[model samples]
Target: MNASRTPLFCDTVLAERIERAEARLMAECCEAAQRGDSPGFVHVLAGGVASFAEDGSPYNKVAGLGFHGVPSAADLDDVEKAFAAHGAVVQVELAHLADPAIGVLLTERGYRLESFENVLGLALDGEYEPVALPGFVIRRSGDDEFEQWLEVVADGAAHPDTQGLPWHEEFPREIYLRAQRHSAAAGEQHYVAVRDGAFVGGAGLRVSEGIAQFAGAATAPAHRRRGVQSALLAARLADARAAGCDVAVITTQPGSKSQQNAQRQGFDLLYTRAVLVKQP
Candidate 1:
């Protein structure tokens, strides 16, 4: 680890690159719904995509907008219509660096600010100190443990720590479980934190275009403050860096313990996204 600060500028090129990779992941996650008793749909509008997991689902929203090109007022109209057709709200996690005019267009079309999420980044141009927790064993999940991983992750999500911005909506545990299944179908690398042969935490990672997305993670309710998540994060960071990614990005609730933990691990705030919604 470098004692000095890491230099990373969140310029348009960087933002665009990150945004595109993330949006592709979202769509890929949705694409997983095409398999085995899933209830998700994906629609491409202009350049971006809208995904529907279920009516009123948090996964039902638009993403990747204003990236390939600035979407027109009519383009947004079609986007809204696409989600509306499925009885879902038109939601967009618009990056602050996106064309200012696009945000203006969304506002003019009635999308209201609902919340914000922080994106922390770590430049992997150098080496990182290895991390190991004494009481926990962290490793990649096995094929036979998919159900176990899903149960652990969904359980943790159901009992999220109260240390960050509260979720905008409360999803059922089943929703989280289904989400993990989709992530698996999209080829996300899964990791588990085990203590005494029991899974205490689970997380996922996906790499695209030299950027590693800490796709999602959660710690079990009974294991919240025992450093399980930190251990998992450190392992993932080192692995991602080893995979040749130039930078890693993770989205977290503003002021979340997750965000705090990431900051301690050499990741800094690269950007914040405004979550906007237009009810259907």
Candidate 2:
């Protein structure tokens, strides 16, 4: 894979850019819930917000802090208390763009480094050759098909290869459904891969600030190795490019098959981010 860099991947700006994007997305989800367009609630914070579902959603977490500068100890203390009030674990995703001192502060405050995710990006300045999965069809999903799309995605996520991974927990069906609805309400584009009119895989795309992010992508167990995901990626990238995005990004576990697939498709490592958590 090419190691070319863009402003979004620059060491000095990468963290903040990612944090901003995440914060924006989360805030939008909160708005959707407040408007009764979806399920969930948003708790505004000093520099970020806490997102929660009526049922426990691991998605409930804090984001977009320590970007302008390292947060004060008192500020961190308050943030922890706020998350605790919501009966949620204090989880934070710190990126390289954050002030280096933020890590030191988190460590001092009882947060443990949980895991790392490789952020990969692909520039959409050139022609993209669409991958053809001979017997599969990929298309954007509509509101009426949300449940079917969620089922396929949840099944794909539960595939054995994804078990025990931080990102692959099997939440209650209600939680998944609510989250999917909230995501759609927040403007995420859902896509599904089908063969013979049956769902085989699914993915989600969110575009902002000239960038398109492949937020979620998975293929059913029986559909693995059949280029289902590649076809989905191709379709999403083409759609994003046509919509005027200059870059496309995705995150995956380091050294996983997903990461390998992304690399094969011209995505390069932008940075690895740390997921930190403090249990009550």
Candidate 3:
């Protein structure tokens, strides 16, 4: 090991990119909820709770209830009943200023808060300085190497606790394949870090609406502590800057290791999202 080598961590500029990605992710989730898209339904699984309910898909389930301009406790009751029928867990997100009174009601009833994320951003054209890893190598993932990436992700997420909220096993596979196809169709970019010919870590960026949203970040457990993730993040930011994006963002749970990593990379906190859970 080189005595002068610096450990892997995020910087200020990279932090901004994650922040921007987070904002886009949150906005997308909210819109999905509003529109009752599959992605949106998954966010709130209140069964048939809303007066106006939209159904969900097999892969990413979602349903919309309640019309605008009218608030009803039945909407919450419907959601609770739905969760009971399915025994499913929903990821409920409410805007910071919207209303926590609802979330507070659920928390008082014994629902877990689970995890939360913070949104951060930075200009895409900004300069990015790489953290040092004397002997590590970074490169873009190859076309036929999807399984490798999946395996790396699976390996990283092997621990039950690391898996976060539970979903059917097939759900992640569906999301992963959809992401791959979306990336190819949209000409997205993915980067990976390799050590001694082993694929150890990865990161990706998708350009939409002239904004580059970063996603698909993972690192093999054994390869952590090396500069793999940091390098992948730096390279992704550099790629975003070159693509003419003005700013980048990322959303992460507050006080998570991911949040600490983003902060160490120099990302400032833009906003925090509060999640609500209602079990029937």
Candidate 4:
């Protein structure tokens, strides 16, 4: 894992690019939540934005703040109070480009580091090798099978390895469906892996500003190690490339199978962000 101080991770231009991408992604999520009436609200913060959902899901948190610089102590206080007002935990995703002092400041203010997530990126300038998985077909999901796709994704989310992660087990069926609907409404593409006419895995691709974000990827437990995810990934990448995306990015827990898979597919380690949380 590349730490924040690594030269490659600290490149000013790359950091700024990543910061903008993250901000755009978070803003999209906030918009999706609002559009779907998913019991959440988004608010602009000093250096970024804050999202809060009534369910206390950790997905509802401040992100993209302090990317250019550390926010003032007063601003942080205000953000915290806003989260508290919503009866939610005070969470923040601190990027490598963020002022290093923010970490110490958060810790001093009763926030604890929860996890490290690796942001991986792959350039789409080259031809991607086709993935052939016998007996399984991957394609863009249609509206008729939305529920099945959701079921497969939800089942995948329940895997032991994913338990306790924010937005993993916390999303109820309705909430998950709402999120997917929002993504579709926002022009994001959804893909599903099918075997013998049964949905086995799924993924989503969101293209914005020439960047394709590969997200919400999961494989049913029964289909693990069967190349379902790889096929899904290939399908999404091809679609994104066709859509004129020059870059593709995804976030995964450091050292997890997902991260390993991404690395194997030519994705370079960009930087790891720390998830910080403060209990109400």
Model 1 lDDT tens row, 153-267: 8888887778889866677776767767777787789899999999989999888989999966998888888788888888888888889999988999898899988887778
What's the lDDT for all of these models? 0.80, 0.74, 0.51, 0.73
TM-score of each: 0.94, 0.87, 0.60, 0.86
Instruction: List the candidate numbers ranked by lDDT, top first.
Output: 1, 2, 4, 3
Model 2 poorest 10 in a row by lDDT: 1-10
- Residue 244 of model 3, lDDT score: 77
Winning model by TM-score: 1
Report the alpha-carbon TM-score of model 1 versus the true structure. 0.94
Q: Which residue pairs clash in candidate 1?
A: none
- Residue 189 C-alpha lDDT in model 4: 74
Give a tens-digit lDDT track for model 2, residues 74-138.
76677667667666677777775567787888898889988877788887887665567788888
Candidate 3 wrong stretches, greater than 4 Å: 1-87, 97-112, 129-132, 159-188
Candidate with the larger TM-score of 1 and 3:
1
Q: After superposition, how far is residue 193 of candidate 4 from its true place, in Å?
A: 0.7
Which regions of candidate 4 fall more than 4 Å away from where they truly are? 1-10, 36-39, 160-175
Q: What is candidate 4's TM-score against the reference?
A: 0.86
Write candidate 3's Cα lDDT for 150-229 as tens digits. Answer: 56755554532242334223334444454344344445566777778888777767775556666667788767766666
In candidate 2, stretches whose alpha carbon ends up further than 4 angstroms from where it belongs are 1-9, 34-48, 160-170
